[model samples]
Target: MINDDAQTRPLFNKIALIGVGLIGGSFALSLKKARAVEHVVGLDRHSTSLKAALQLGIIDSFTDDMASAIADADLIVIATPVAQTTKILSSIYPYLQSNTIVTDVGSTKADVVLAARTSLQEKVSQFIPAHPIAGREKNGPEAAIDDLYVGKKVVITLLAENADQSIELVAQAWRLCGAIIHHLSPKEHDQVFASVSHLPHLLAYALVDDIAAKPHADRLFQYAASGFRDFTRIAGSSPEMWRDISLANRTAILEELDSYSAKLQQLRASLEASDSVALEAIYSRAQTARVNWITAIEAAESQNKDGGD
Candidate 1:
């Protein structure tokens, strides 16, 4: 299954991806595009997903058998939904090679780490909890694109028992797919994502649902402008996936919700008192801060490209 087009050898002999959904498929395709792996063997319980992955050439081969799929795999990516991650990892623990490096694309890291620690036990050293901060509202293999992770940030949660080689290998795989890596403790990763990612999705779903419940909902939606579209875009995300993330990171999410509620109360009081100056200042500061952040990010990206060249 090895295919090397140049002098450099492939980084992995085989990468066993346990899900054929957007994240897993995109990673497989990206690795294939980079010729970074000799073989990508996909495993999924869903027939449609496996079929689509095979037809689209996202994987070199696929299997429904857990043991067979991961036999001698140098790297294993557990890309199943957050809820199923623990069960999947536990099932594949015995099948993984001694040197196999295990990583995941789950949005929440604490629950995943707990699952690995409890299920994998001593073998947990091979498991490196990771979350690639990339993807779309869309789902399934058809929604996967090769460059979905390019230039995106991937956060890896380092565990106490993890081997240095395992961490390096997992990070190297993500680097091959053009991702910038960041490290955090599993707790820190969960808290950070709850504020920036999970809470927003919950807000979007609430906003969309609130509007849909109105009497003239259809008419209102039809007349909605880019503002509404932009704000509620993530409402179209996979409910199952978001639900798992919300619950898995419930503690941090609840804290964030409380903070947001307090902020909203202050904004509400400002509006009630007709404090136009306060409102204007808030909005103006947000605008400036966002623009500055964007400019800095773009400049850094340009610098990175120039440096790479």
Candidate 2:
């Protein structure tokens, strides 16, 4: 159980946010909003982002030195891209304190867990893997919001080496940020997100790329409407970040891509055969599923609001 005094006292004396971008910046802001952290130290290889984080008050201070940044930190959050997990964890290993709890906001978990196992080795118990199911299309510290995780879901994948006390502390920190926690094994998390989150981003990027590569790209873009804009909005996200994510979770993503390709082939066959019944059956089912999912989401949000009040 979390301490009842969580509401009145800070959960951590200091927090180290290794990457002060959207997710990390927002986490710091949310913790400050909840009065759950006394100090936040931001670390990033990009000095420009570090400057932005300091100016925006996303962190109490910014540092390039990993040792200084994580020194005495009660919690350390590795918020970099998934591909950087191994490097970041290895760098911190030398300085990581036994009492400090380490967590990450990576989208995929299997690879991260493997990286933790490889990098942290026997001390892997101090590391807890987490993914916050929330973000905006925008990036950087300027895009962060204090309420980004409010009413949002955060998935936690526990390591075999983890202690119950360490797990609870990490969970309590996120709870203070207003994130509802869910548990899953690393493989389950990667598989689920590959289908829902990763695949969608890949499809959006592919669609946009296909159109942009055509000779009439400018004309098509000039006439592009809300549907195109809405569908390809994710394509405007950081390509570098998405590239890392795609490769990191390629196994699950490839499986999902194959499944999506089969569905697309069925649509193509229906169109070629002029089978209106088949097409309508597919469209109707998709529409109904979308509507039902949205309805459930809205209901859940409303319930959360009422409960909070």
Candidate 3:
């Protein structure tokens, strides 16, 4: 349990956030709301994103120069797309301070961890790979919300000899934003998230693509409603971002995809055979699973509030 008094402690003297998109902007907003950092600086390649971040007052300052942005930061968050993480680490490696604690909001962990270990080993102890299981289908700064990570699960993948203080600081920062922190190794993190997160996104993309490829695609889309909209929502996410994540966690995602495909085929076969009993059983199981998941979420939320108090 986190000490409630510790919640008032300033986590970082200066925090540098790279890529002011949904995740980065949300972090800045949460930090300001909790007063977790004395200074927050946003860095992005896009001038428009930087300008909008400033206009939204998500950060105290903005810069395009990676080094200048992270120069004296006590905590640095790489919030760029997964594909850009390795390159960003290479660019920011030379400027990272000795005691600086660095983390990321990338969806995949194995590749991000590998990049940091290979290019920034000296800073590896401070590089804690993290992924917040919270986001909308929307992209960019305009889609960011202060409570984006609120009540979401944030997974932290720590290095073998990671500093305890750094891990604690990262956990505190997430908690301040109303997240439940969970610790996992890079391998376990990749596997679990691949099944739960990456696989779903892949299915969403595939489903929407399949529908869009139909001859009457435009006319079919006109009939889409709440169910179609909800299921295919993540298909609207940035293609570049999803592309990177797919490649980064390819192995685990493929395995899950195969399993999901087999299950889907079985259901399709049952439907074609008019096996109402099997279809009914499958729907019943899905409904029960959803109910249990909701109950678990409510329980966790209750616990988080109690712990915060």
Top TM-score: which candidate number? Answer: 2
lDDT of 3 by residue, 1-309 (tens): 223555665667788988889998998888778877778898888989989988888878887777777778888899988989888888878888777888999999989999998878677787888999889878888888988887789999888868888889888899889888998888898899888888888889988999889999999999999999889888888899989999999999899989999999999999999999999999999999999999998998888678767
Superposed model 3: Cα runs more than 4 Å off: 1-9, 302-309
The lDDT of each candidate is 0.88, 0.92, 0.86
* Cα lDDT of model 2 by residue, 1-309, tens digit: 234676676888899999999999999999898888889999997999999998998999887888988879989999998899999999999999888889999999999999999999888999999999998899999999999998899999998789999999988888878889999999999999999999999999999989999999999999999998899888888888899999999999999999999999999999999999999999999999999999999999999878766
User: Higher lDDT: candidate 1 or 3?
Assistant: 1
Model 1 compared with the native: what TM-score? 0.95
Query: lDDT for model 2, on a 0 to 1 scale?
Result: 0.92
Q: How many residue pairs clash in each candidate?
A: 0, 0, 0
Could you tell me every candidate's TM-score relative to the true structure?
0.95, 0.97, 0.93
Which pairs of residues clash in candidate 1, taking residues 3 or more apart in a chain or in different chains? none
Quote the lDDT for 93 in model 1: 74
Winning model by lDDT: 2
Q: What is the Cα-based lDDT of residue 21 in candidate 3? A: 90
